[model samples]
Target chain A: MKVLVAVKRVIDYNVKIRVKADQSDVDLTNVKMAMNPFCEIAIEEAVRLKEKGIATEVVAVSIGPKAAQEQLRTALALGADCAIHIETDERAESLAVAKLLAKVVEEEQPGLVILGKQAIDTDNNQTGQMLAALTNLPQGTFASEVVVDGDKVNVTREIDGGLQTIALTLPAIVTADLRLNEPRYAKLPDIMKAKKKPLDVKTPADYGVEIASKVSLLKVESPAERKGGIKVASVDELIDKLKNEAKVL
Target chain B: MSILALADLHEGQLAGATARVVAAAQAIGGDIDVLVVGEGVHAAAEAAAKLDGVSKVRVADNAVYAHQLAEPMGALLVELADGYTHVLASASTTGKNVLPRLAALKDVSQLSDVIAVESADTFKRPIYAGNAIATVKSDEALKVITVRTTGFDAVSDGNSAPIEVVDTVVENNQSSFVKEELAKSDRPELGGAKMVISGGRGMGNGDNFKLLDGIADKLGAAIGASRAAVDAGFVPNDMQVGQTGKIVAPDLYIAVGISGAIQHLAGMKDSKVIVAINKDEEAPIFQVADYGLVGDLFEILPELESKL
Candidate 1:
């Protein structure tokens, strides 16, 4: 079985994102960019499958600006065979991204597709499931654990109440959750090797997919800051405030 | 314009989040219709009919929808996509799993986890873990949306809408229901609870969670954990409250030893009142907290338990 892992480049998780002064969008002028945390987990899962001899190959794919190739290279360093970059300047929404990936799925002919549950930049947990819908494949989302049997994949999903397990046929889509597996950092040698790996760059138009955003962004602004109130000096005072002042107790 | 709100039905009862979604749909200003899709979901349909602003309830009772599985549910929504100007659902795991599929099937974008309905075509949602709010307008004629129910107040029961059985259940043989291991708790659910008490890495171990049990039981508060605590294997993942975890809003939220990472604050900052108890006085949690107490959790928690 072959696995295709979709990765994305987003603002590093540790960075505090700032909205531009004009409120057009987040300030990305000199911000640090890294592979999306969940996508790294997905790549790690696929590579682990390959290491275990359950998968024959793992291909990394990304859809973003030209700079997104950095994320693809990172994926390659993490043990993906090669990289595919769908170059686009437009911030394509989940619908368009899924369509492009669906076309790529047809070209790749992989038995399993793995993607992050959501991207940190847009916070849209849609693309993987959307790809599954477009290709009429079963999706196991928010997967914390995945095991491949003879022709079926057993996935443990992290849901609201607890975990839910589902089994899908070989050709399925699985979205990685945080607890899936901690991604391994690429060694210096692997990073150097990834620099020389084969990378194919294509435009969305190459797949006959239009890169039009369906949602129009009107504005972006910082969330309202909560003003801190004076703290009580003692537990008695805290209880008094809770009982009399806030009346929440 | 007409809004079709998908009822979040688990088993046979209408989820409380469905009422909140209906309220969000009402805010969008439209004739609202509730779609209840499940097996033996007449009770859910009846409950949806009683929602304050619903005009009609459509029930598509089928075995394929028994577990809110995505495959058949997404196909059914796509088949019924016509004739509705807007399709809304609660931003639950089920809705998150299905709405995007429907949007893709229609070749349109989905506005997800919407915190406010700005206009018929515009919505305000949290991006980058609620640090920033983005106002977005969808050009798609048929808008597919999912609202974070915590952002909207649930509607009260006051209407008697007509229940119409919908026979437009699309069938798919892609996946089937598997076993679920839900946490059986006697306390109120975290999302619906009036009060919440959450711990973080400072709790040390799973055994230390007992320090909160006495207080939680006394106050009828739901127990939660910061992502660090969950990552430390001190609690189940479901108890996690953060950006990638469960978003919760209650009347009162107490943070015990929770330093409050940006992601964790995004989930609980919407609570009416927040109290942070951390030994680090400079912890960022205190910045947004209405009340802050600086002390060792082991001493403070025991003291709090004794006093309360």
Candidate 2:
């Protein structure tokens, strides 16, 4: 079976994001960039499927600025056989990205598609499901556990409720949840090998897909800083403060 | 201008988030029409009709909408949204699943999880897990948005509006619904609960969650856990309350032994009142908390339960 995984480049999870001075966008000048952590998990899952002999080929795809090619290369190093970089300087929203991915899906008819539940930067958990809807495929989103049988894939999803186990037919889309698997660090040898791997480039226009903006960002601002509260001495004082001052008890 | 809102219903009742989305729709200009699609969902449709600021309730009753799967729903919404300028839904699992599909199918960009409506075409949303807020303006012909229900008040109950039956069905038999293995919990649901009591890795064992039951019951709160507690196998993923987990804005949020990681704070910082109980005085939770109790939760929880 063929598996396609979508990866994204975003600010590293550890770096605290800062709003730009003008509050129009995030300040990205000095921030450390890395592949989205959940996307890394998706890459790890696809590599595992190939290692288990269940998948014949794994292709990693990224739609972002040219710098996002670094994320595709990282995916290749992590174990994706080939990579596709849809170069665009536009900061595409989830719907636009999903449209681009759906165009790719039509060109490359992979039986299974794996992607992160959402990107850390946008946090719009939409692409995988949108792709599934566009292609008329089943979607098992926020999957913590995925098991493949002959033609059926049983996915245990992490939803608002507890775990929900859904059995989908072949040719489905699954988004990786946090607890899905721990992604591995790319070894130096693999990184060197990834340089030699096949990397294909495309554009959103190549697929005749138009990214229409529905929401325009007015400003980006830091969240309201929480003020520090006075520390109480005794449990009784805490109770008194809660009742008299806070009135939240 | 009239805004069309989609009501996400499971079984036969309005999801709690639907009212919040209605409230968001009311914040923006115009008459609101709510659409309820599902088989045997008349009860839900009727319930949605009762929400304030709703001018009309459209019910699309069909067997294909049994699961109200994203594909069919997207197609239906596309057909129904031809005249409406704005389409809104709660940013719940259902809304997140369906609206993006509609946007992609319609070749329109979708704004996910808006926290505030600045105007008809502009909104504010949390980008980096509530670390930063982005105010956006849309120039698209049609605006597709999912409202972060926690950021808005739910429409008050009263005044049932007229219900309109929309006879629209789009057939795309691409997927089948398999049986679901839903994990049942005796406690209230995390997102819908009025109060929440969450524990972190400091809770120690899986069984230690029982100690929280007394206080939770006293406060009528749902039980939640931090990612650390969930990763430690002390609780299920559904119990997780954080950036990557469920975002809850309850009346009161009691964080027990939780050292307020930024991710954890993202989910519950919108709570009306926050109280932290931890041994570490330097824990980050104290910063956002309205009340702080520096003590071991294991002892304080029981004592607090007795006192309550």
Candidate 3:
């Protein structure tokens, strides 16, 4: 069985985002970029499955500008057998990315597909479910655990209340959540070996998919800042403020 | 224009977020119809009918939708979405899981976690972990959206709407529910609670979480934890309150021993009043807290509990 993992390059999670001066969009000038945190978990899960012999090969695919190859190479260093980069300069929305991945799924014919539940940049948790709908595949999203057993994969999902386990047939979709697994950093030797790995760069037009924008960005601005109040001298003062000043009690 | 809103339910009981989603639908200025899809969802459908501004309630009762799995639910919504101009649901786990599939099947883009409805097609949503807010406009004919319930006020139950049974039954052979382990608690749900007290990595371990119980019981508050606490194995993921976890904005939020990260602040910063109790004076939690008490939580928890 083959595993196809979709990775995305986004602004680093640690960076404080600054909106552009003209309010057109977020400023990406000289910003640090990295693979999304959730995508790292997805890659780790796929590599672990390959180590366990449940997956015969692990293929990593990413969609972005040409610079996205850096993330695919990182996936290769983490243990993906190969990488594919869908080159697109236009900002690919979730639907466009899902359509591209559905095309890739058709060509690769991987038994399992994995993606990050949401991207840190857009914070939109839509790609995996959209791809599932487009490809007519069952989906186990927000998965913390994936167990492959005899043509069925049992996925333990993290729900709002607790955990829910569901079983899906082969050739399904699974989105990695936060607690899925702790991602491993690539070693120096592996990083060197990743440079020699085969990487295929293709355009969205190559797969007959158009990367078009459906949502227009009208403006971007900072949220209202919550100002900190005075520090209480004692617990009694805190209670007094809550009961009398704020009147929330 | 007609709008279809999906109800959020658990164990046949309607979730409070459904009312909030309806509130968002009402903002769109349309005839709102709520859809309840589940096994034996008559009670939930009746509850949906009572929400203000709802004109009708559509119920699809079937075993296939018992878990409200995305596959069948998405198909059912696609079938029922011909004349509706907008489809809305709460940005809960169920909505986040299913709405995108419906959007894709309809070939329309979905605006997720919409915090403000600027117009019929424009919305304001947070990006970059709530660091920046982006106003977006969708050109798609059919608008699909998931509402951040905390941003909208829940409507009161006043109007009694008519209930209609949806006869469309979707067949599913691709997936099946194996089991579920939901935490049973007497406290109000964190998302809908009036008061919330959350702990973090400073609690040390799972057993230490018991300290918050006394204060919680006294204030009638729901207990939550930061991602650090959940990731540290001090509590379950369901109790997590952060960007990727439950987004809660209660009337009063108290942070106990929580050194707030930005992600954690994103979930509860909208709270009416925030109180922070942590040993670290430099903790980020104090930045957003309306009242700050810097001290040891071990000593503060008991005193806070007894005083309340």
Interface CA root-mean-square deviation for model 2: 1.9
The candidate scoring highest on DockQ is 3
lDDT of 1 by residue, A70-150 (tens): 999999999999999999989888888899999999999999999999999999999999999999999999999998888
Fnat per predicted structure, each in turn: 0.79, 0.70, 0.90
- The lDDT per prediction is 0.91, 0.86, 0.95
Residue A110 CA displacement from its true place in model 2, Å: 1.0
Interface quality of candidate 3 as DockQ:
0.91
Residue pairs of candidate 3 with colliding backbone atoms: none
Show model 2 residue runs off by greater than 4 Å: A210-214, B183-187
Q: Chain A TM-scores, all candidates?
A: 0.98, 0.97, 0.99
Best by TM-score: 3
- When sorted by lDDT, best at the front, the candidate numbers are 3, 1, 2
lDDT of each residue in B222-293, candidate 3, tens digit only? 999999999999999999998899999999999988898999998999999999999999998899999999
Can you give the DockQ of every candidate in the order shown? 0.81, 0.66, 0.91
